[model samples]
Structures are given as C-alpha cells and as structure tokens.
Target: MANDDLIYKTATEISALFRKRKLSPVEYMAAVIARSEAAQKKINAFTFTHYDEAMDLAKQAEAKFMKRDGRVGVLEGLPIAVKDESWIAGKPTSYGSLTVGKGYVPDRTSPNNERILKAGAIVHARTATPEFSCASYTHSRLWGVTRNPWNRRYTPGGSSGGSGAALAAGMAPLATGSDIGGSIRIPAGASGVVGYKPPYGRNPDDPPFNLDPYCHTGPMARSIQDAILLQNVMCGPSPHDIASLRPKLRLPTEYKPIKGWKIAYSFDLGIYDVDAEVVANMKKALRVFKNLGATVEEVDLGWTRDAIDTGMRHLEHLFGTQLALTAKKHSKIMTTYARNFARKGAKSKASDFFKSMEGAVRMYDTFGPMLEKYDVFICPTNAAPAVKADFDENKDVVRINGKVSPLPKVLAWCMTTPFNTLSRCPVLAVPTGHASNDVPTSIQIIGRTYSDADVFRAGIAYETAIGGWYGSRKARPVL
Candidate 1:
C-alpha cells in the first residue's frame, strides 16, 4: 500500500491488515511517522513527536506478531496520538502553559493514557493545545498556531485542536480529547473528524476533574468504529479515580440498526445564532436520517441566554478560579488569554455558582423529558465553521448570520457546551459537510444521560447511510 493509504486507514482497517500479516507494525509506524512529519510542517499540530520510541515499540510489536503471540491487546500496533494536556510518565508535560509547568514531567501516568499504553498502542506524538487549554483557538506562547488541515488560514479549534488536525491530516489513526466547554467537539466539528465526549465517569480521569461532571476524557478518530475501538480500552473503573463508573460499560463495536427510531434535532438549540452553512448541512444530515428509516423532528429547547451564561460560570468556578490564582502568582509568564480568562473568572461571586447549578437543572428539566420521548437528540456541534488561527478571544467578535455577537465569550460560538452543562449525557460530534469558508461543519448525536450506546448506534447508522469523513480523499484536507 502507498504511504498515504496506510496513514489514512482507520484503526479497524489497519488492525485487520495487521492480523492478516499484510501490514507489519514497523511498516505502519514508518508510514505514520512520515505522514506526521509532513502534517506537522504544514499545520504545526504536534508539540512533540515520539518517533524514536515509537519505532522501537513498533519493531517489538512486529516480533510478537511473527512469534504468533496470543497476548496482543485490542489496539495492538495502532499509532495513537496523546493529547499534551494528559500526563505521560517521564515525558515533559507543559499543559500548554509555561507558568504552572516549568518543564514538569510527572512520574505517574494518567489513567486513560495508561490504558492506551497497556492496550499495545504506540504513542507516536503529543498534540498541542492553547496555553493552559484555556481558549477555543489553539495557538499559545509555548507552541505556535495549529491550523486546520482543510484550510491553513483557519484554526482547527481547541484545546483538542492538534488532535483533531492530526486525525484529519492522518498523523494518527486514533487520539485522545478532553471536553470542558466544548474543547473536544469544537475541534471535531472544525476539523471534520469523529469525537465522542462520553458521559462523565464513563472514562477514568485524573484528580479533581474526575469529580467535575462538565469535564470528560474521550476518543477521537476518522470513523465511529475506530472511536469505539479506542473507547473500549480507555474506559472502565480505575483504583485511582473514585468517580469512575463501576462494573464498567464496554460499548459494542457493532451497533443495532436505527431504523424505526425517533430522533430530535435543533439547529441552534433554541438560543445562539448560527451560520447559514451550518443550518443547511444540518438539514441535509436530517434528511439522511429520514432516508435511513428513522423519524426526524425539530424540537424547541427554549434554552435562554442564561444557558450560555450558566455554562461560562460553571467553567469560571471550576477552571477559571484556579487559573486566576495561578496568574496572580505568575502573571509575567502566563499567556495574555490565560491571564484575561482568570480576570473574568475572578469577578464571579460564590452565590453566582448556585445559579449555574440551577441552570443545569433547568436545562435537564426540559431535555430529560424530550430525551425520554426520542431515542436521540441531534444538533450542530459548532455555530460557525471555524475562527482564524490567530483569532484572540479577548479582542475578537464572532459574527453569525452577519450579526456581531457579544465579545469575550468566544466559547459561545460553539453549541457543544450546553451539553457539557448536561454532562452525564453522551455526545458524539461527526462531520456533516464543508462550509463556504472551506472548514467542515458537524452534527452532534446526543443520547440520554448514561445511555452511551444509543448515540453510537445512531452515529454508525448515519455513518453507514452516508459514508464517513474518510469516504472521499477529495473531501479530506489537501495538506
């Protein structure tokens, strides 16, 4: 197979070839490394590449296969990209911040990442993020701008921007992403890839964040099946994370047909202003669901502007408060965006946080019943196609449908965060179509809280009806 062919192949396809001995692990590693180098040059997607260690691991995997060892794990020999925000033992973890992370390298590994390594997956690179993973765009003082593979002028979205770009550019077959205020799905929608933010506790995470429902660590890939492939290994209970669900749920690789199922879709979730291209693509996607023998209906969420405010407040209380404290101590070294985000967070009151919790309850009061009637809810992952790579959250105003939106709430441009407020629900963001701006648009499949399987079932059904993002090399980023 040609190098590009191997690079673009899904994990399932690659594993099949590996089992058949048609593609050796060493060969696959070389192909991925070459593709990653080319992609990095074009998009600046990775902060660090582990080519030397990856090559050694690939050779060992090949030897095991040659000996016909039955000890292979589910993700045996697949190249996976680790997000820099997650800890990898003995590797420098900057968390995209020079202040808190003074070249710090942890001795312990994050639970989900440890699972990835144990699954026989090769970590070929560490993807970039905004400083402190604090913004919707992926440029930082530590690493340069991370651009979309589809259009160099636009951003890939953050803080999982690098992961999304790498997957689109075929830098890796699978990668990890964390969602808090739409970090995972925003990039997924922007870069035209598959990203799943599993229900809180579905996947084990390290400390304090594991207790925060709005934060999730999940999988990103080129196909739904590949996302499931990685999720199966990354999920389950961990001794370190008490919040992790017990009697762990392992999602099925094969999904039941969505024929005769009822689906609810909303373009703007009844509040935020959305671009016309996003609306058009969502309409087309709804048609595909109807063509697949499913009933698609539009629902009114009646979610007010308060929903956006509440979500932002929750972020402020969680990450923003601490970020502000860090800025106070190291304002000189912190990124301007980080310092500004901290300043905004510092202004909120303790009582205001209660209002945020009230907002989540109100959102669920409406959605919980709607979900009971419908098997799944569908919506645009992002309101706009994507912002510029260098767009500043502090200074930029997002325009949707030719109307300028409120500034400094750049996270508002994405529709993915309200679901973060309803964090127990499983959300899957997949490419819908490309906009006139040349960035890909996406639709999210939302299942009832903790009903993770329903979303994937719906996702695969749609994926089968209209092939996946990898369906056409023409549709893929030219880079």
Candidate 2:
C-alpha cells in the first residue's frame, strides 16, 4: 500500500489488517508516528508525544496478534491521539491553559482515557485545545494555533480542535474529544472528520464534570465505525462517575435502515444568522437523507438568542469563574477571551445562574415535544466553515447573512450550545460538505434524549450515502 494509504486507514481497517497479518502493528505505528511528525509541522495539533513508549506498546500488541490468541481488544494496535485536556496517568494535562498546569501531572488516569488504554490502543500523542478548552476555535497562549488541514489559514474548531485536525491530517486514526459546547462536533465539522457527542452519562466521564450533564467525553475519528469502536470501550458505568448510565449501552456494528424515518432539519434553530454555504450544504445533506428513504421536513425550534446567553452564563458559573480567578494572578499571560470569560463568570450573580437553568427547561419544553414528532433533528454544526486560524473569540465579528450580530451572541456561530443545555440528547457531527474556502462543514444529527443508537444509525446511513469523506485519497486533505 502507498504511504498515504497507510496513514489514512481508519481504525477498523487497521485492526482488520492486523488480524490478517497484512500489516504489522509495529509497522503501522511507525508510519503513524512519521506521518504525525510531518502533520505536526503543518498544523501544530499535538502538544505532547511519547513515540518511544508508543512503539513499545505496539510491539506488545503485535505479539498478541502473532500468538493468534483470542485476547485482542476491538481497538488493539491502533494509534490514537488523546486530547491534552484528558489526564493520562503521570502525563501533564494542560487543559489548554498556560497560566496553570504548565507541567502539572496527574497521578491517576481519567476514566475515559483508562478505558482507551485498556482497549489495547497505542497513545502516541496529545492534541491541543484552547486555554481551559474555553473557545470554539483552537488557539491558545500555551499551544498556539491548530490550523485546519484542508486550509491552514482557518481554524480546525475547538476545544477538540487538535483531535479533529490530527484525524483529518492522518496523524492518528482515532482520538478523544470532550464537548461542553460543541467542542467535539465543532472541530469535526471544521476539520471534516467524525465527532460523536453521546448523551450525558452514556460515556463515563471524570470528576465534577461527570455530574454536569452539559459536559461529556466522547470519540472522534475519520470514520463512524472507528468512532463506534472507540466509544464502546470508553462508555459504561464507573464507580468514580456516579452519573454514568446503568446497563452499559453497546451499539451494534450494523444498523437498521433509516427507511420511512422522519427527520426534522432546522437551518438556524429559529434564530442565528446562517451562512449561505452552510445552508446549501445542509440542504444537500437533507436531500441525501431523502434519497436514502427518510422523509425530511423543515421545522422551527423557536430558540432565541437567550440560548447563547444562558449557555455562556452557565459555563461561566461552572468553569469560567474558576479559571478566571486562577488567571487573575497570572493575568499577563492569559488570552483575551479567557480573561473576559473569567470576568463575566466572576461578576455573574446567582440569579443569572438560575435564569440559565430556566433556559434549559424552556428549551426542553419545546424540544421534548418536537422529538416526539420527529425521529431526529438536523442542523449546521458551525454557521461558517471556520474562523481564521488566529480568530479572537472576544473581539472578532462573524458576519452572518451579511449582518453582524451583537458581541454576546458570538456563540451563535456554532449552533451546538442549545443541545448541550438539553444535555441528554445524543449528537453526532458528520461531514455535510466542504465550503468554497476549502474548510469542511457539517450537520448535527441529534437523537432523542439518551437515544444514542439512533443518532449513530442516521450518521452511518448518511456517511454511507456520501461515500465517507476519507475513503478516497483525493477527498482527504492535501497535508
């Protein structure tokens, strides 16, 4: 196989080849490390790497296959990139902030990362994120900018931007991503990969975040199957995360046809100014669903700018203030947006937090009823293909439909926050199409609360219909 073919193979493909001895795990790991090094020079996706340690793991994985024992895990021998925000035993987890945790290391592993390690996957690199995973674009005072592989001038989307960019650039076949406000899906949409934001507790998380329904840790991959492969390992009940769902859900590799299913699509979720390119691609995606035997209809979500306000305020209450207070001492080193978020969070009152909860109730009041009527909901993942690689979250204006909106509503660029408010719904961000700017765009396939399987079913059907973006070399990124 050509070198590009090796680098671009999905985890599923790699696993299959390993089983057949067509590709050795050691050989694949070397290719991955080499490709990752090259991609890093271009996009700055990974922050930390342990290629030497990863090679040893690959050798052990290769031995398992050589023994022909039935001891292999589903993801055995695949190279995976872990997001910098996740803890990995003794490794330093920056969480994308330079002000704190510069070289701080965790003695214990995060539940999700532990599961990935147990699945026999090789963790070769750690991807970048915005400081404290705060922004929608992936650039930070610590790790600089993580550019889109398709267009270096644009961002790959964040706080899972590094994971998304690494996958698109073939730095790794599978990676991890966390989504509070579209961190996973935003980068998936921007980088043209696949990101799955499973319903809260569907995939076990670590810490206070595990209890916060809006926060979740999930899978990012080049293909939906590879994503499923990783997600299965990462999900389940954990003693550390009391909120994890019981009777651990394991999705099947095969999905029932989506024929005769009803799908409701919203261009703007009732409010934000959407770009024509994003709308055009979403319309095309809807057509693909129609072609695949599902009925697509347009619906009004009745959402308002308050959704953005509520989300930001709630996040401020949860993580913003904590980060802000910490950055206050190191104010000189913090990014402008991080500092602003801190100030807003610091000044936010209890009433503001209560009102944000009210927004969640208000959203579910309408969305809960809408789900009963439609099998799933679809919408653009990001309003625009991407912000500039160095886009400033606080000062930049994202012009939509030829008009600039208010500064506070900037989160509106990503139509993902409202769903985070609804928390239990499973959202899968899949590639819809690419924009003229060459950056990729996507639509969110949202299922009823906790109906994780349904979103995957819809995603697989759509991905199959669209020929899976990374299936063709010409379709892959030039970098």
Candidate 3:
C-alpha cells in the first residue's frame, strides 16, 4: 500500500494499534498533519492548525497507553478537528466571515467542545465554514472555496465543506460538524464520507438558545462506525440545553443487523425531480438493505415541491439572520452570496417568518405518524452529483435532467434538509457508489427521532456489504 493508503485507518482501528504499541498517536498525528498540510495548500480546508499542540496531546495519549491499564475514552488519541463556528476558548471563532477580523476570542467555550476534550479527544485544528454558515456551500471572501477531494473540480459540499474535505483527503479520521439544514449530510454525500446528524441536543450547545433549541452538534467520520463511536462520546443531556433528551441512554453495545427493520425509501420525497442516475443508485442501495433483511418499501413524505418552497421562503430567515448580525462592517469584502443572504434575512417580515415556521409545524405533525410504520427513512442524499468547482451556491440555477427545477440555489434537490426542518430526526449519509461521470454519490439512512445510533447501525450494515465508499481517485489539487 502507498503511504497515503496506510493513512486511512479509522479511529477505532487506530486506537487498537496505539494500545498495542504498533502505532503511536504521535505518528498518526504527524501523518494526518502532513496530509492536512499538503491538502490545505490546495483546498484551504482549515482556518487554523495546532501542529505543536497536536504533538503535545499525542505525547499525553502515548503516555496513557504506556501505563496500559484500560481502554481509553471513546475518542482516546484521535486527532479530532472542530468547525470554526463552534467556540473554542483561546482559539478565534470566525463564523467563516471576515467581519470579526480578530476582535473576539471566546473566554467561555461551547459545552460540545468541552465534552469532546473531557473524552480525551485532541482537537488540533479549526475547519472553515461558509460566512456565518449562511449559505450551504463553503465559499467566503475571507477563506475562499474549499475544494472537493475526489475531483477537486467539484465542491466537497458545504457549511461542513471543510470537515468533509479534510476527512475525504485523509486529513483526519473524524471531525465535529453542526447541521441545521443538511450542513452535515450534504458534505458527507458530496465527499463520500459518512456523516451523522443526531437528534437535536444529542450533543448540547452553549447557553442563550440552549434553553430549548433545534441545533445539534454531531460527528463526521470516514465510516459509519467511526461516526457512531464519536457521537457515543459526544451525546448526553446537558444542564444548559433544555431541549436535550432526558435520562441518557447507553449506546447499543451490539450493532448486529436488526432482523427486520422497516425502511421507507423515496427517490424524490414524492415530488422532487431527481436525476435519473440518483434514483438508480438509491434503488441499488435499498436493494442492499433488502439483502440485509430489511423490509424496504416506497413511501412519501406528503410534501410537494410547492409546500417545501412555501416553507423555505419563511424558514430561510433563521440562517439569514446571522449574516445581518455581521454584514455591515464586512459588506465591502463579503461574497455577494453572503451580502444578499444577510440583506434578505434582515428584510424578512415577521409575518413571513411565522408563516414558514407554521408550515414547518404542519409538516412535522404529519411526519410523526408515518414514522410509526417504519424504522428509518432512506433516500438519495442529494438531488444530484457533486457540483463543479465553479457552481455558485447563491445564484446558480440547477437543471435536473435538462428540466429547470424550481428548488432554490444550493438547497435544491436535497432530501436531508427536510428532516432538519421536520421531526428533528437524525440522518446519516453513507456513500453508495460512483457514477459514470466520475462524481461520487450517496444514500441517506435516517432513523426515528432520537434513534441516532440506529441510523449509523444501519449504515454500518450497508457499508460492510458494499466494502465502504472511498473514491478510486487519489488526493490531488482541484485548481
């Protein structure tokens, strides 16, 4: 195997090797750092890296193994990476925009970061995100576009774009990602990595909105098992987050295929004009689930394109609001998309915002009954293949199979975002196969609300049968 090939071990595999003295965390850290340095020059995937700090953590991890008494925490010597949006004390939080420049260094940190550190995971770098994470794709005047790893000519997907790129490029085995609207799943599918977006509050955030909220901090990893392992560490009810689930539950110790789990599959959620090849790959994946003893069936989410469109107009203000908070001072240097997104957010009337929130409630109310009939919902992770590098997330119009689709911007053809808006379900995006066009594709496995582990368990079964989805191409610069 080539040196790059040897660098692809998952966190669990690395920990075992570390415990046996076959590999040192320091060696693993250096290997990943070297990969990150090479890929960073091309992809700009990171906002910051702590090479010295990472080595120091590795030395501590190495010493723990030297004592050799028990298994380390779930993260144990893993070289974890954090998104720039999540606050890390002493480290600058940029929210992917240049407006903040360097004024704020958080004295207080997010509980999510604290939880990971308590588990012994070493967070050695901060990944880039879209400006205020306003748009779906990761492009900002401050950090530039984060290119895809498979065919650098394409986007790795966004918000979590840097996390996705870093993982696919072998920069890290696992990283932290937050998804409000497919930020986790889109990039996971785009980059052919497995990303898990757990139920809201599975990993708690800091105060303010913590009283009761919908946002989640989840795990993005190279495979389903890796995603599961990291989430296992990160999950638990928080004193700060009232929305957090009560009475912590243990991670299912066994992930064996459930003998008969009912899975509902949809190509377009009933009304989406998905690419034909995307439909075919989704079908291929459902068949794999069938072979694994799952009862796969056709199901509809009861949402027409019109309904979703109506909801989006009102719902988008939530994200646009952040841009307005940072836009004026940074407007001159902001990407056009960021500026527009902020202005639109600031202009949204309360009537439109509430109307959208109400529309979202209607969707969720109808979705709950459907879940009673199924163990999970399976769908195409995205409506299309990885978009070309120049594909603009803000202004680009997407055509599906030559038909001009109505879905707006980067949000079009997405199956993962609806879950974010409805039922607060957890979804895992796992690679299915490659298309003839050299773009990678994926299948989404969504579990019932709060059954985050189930989604990953199913993903592990699918991945094991398919031998996991790594692109055939080696890492190279897109530009």
Instruction: For each of the candidates, give the backbone clash count.
Output: 0, 0, 0
lDDT of each: 0.89, 0.88, 0.76
TM for every model, in the order presented, reads 0.98, 0.98, 0.93
Cα lDDT of model 3 overall?
0.76
Q: Model 2: per-residue lDDT, tens digit, 1-479?
A: 88888888888988999998899999999999999999899999999999999999999999999885668987888889999987888888888887765698999999988888888988899999998888888888888889999999999998899999999999999999999989999999999999999998888887878888889899999889988999899999998989998988999878989999999989988777788999999999999999999999998878887878878878889777677678769878888878877888788888988999999988888889999999999999998888888987556787777788663633657888888998999999999889998999899999999899899999999888888877778898997
User: What C-alpha RMSD separates each model from the true structure?
Assistant: 1.1, 1.2, 2.5
- lDDT tens digits by residue: candidate 3, 441-460: 78887777777667867877
Which 10 consecutive residues of model 2 have the lowest summed lDDT?
A: 404-413
Please give the distance, in angstroms, between residue 273's alpha carbon in candidate 3 and its true position after superposition. 1.8
How far is 68's C-alpha from truth in model 1 (Å)?
Answer: 2.2
- Residue 286 in model 1: shift from native, Å? 0.3
Candidate order by decreasing TM-score: 1, 2, 3
Best by lDDT: 1
Counting only residues 3 or more apart in sequence or on different chains, how many pairs clash (N, Cα, C under 3 Å) in candidate 2? 0
lDDT for 217 in candidate 3 is 73
Give per-residue CA lDDT, model 1, range 291-341, as digits (tens). Answer: 988999999987888888889888888788879888888888887788887
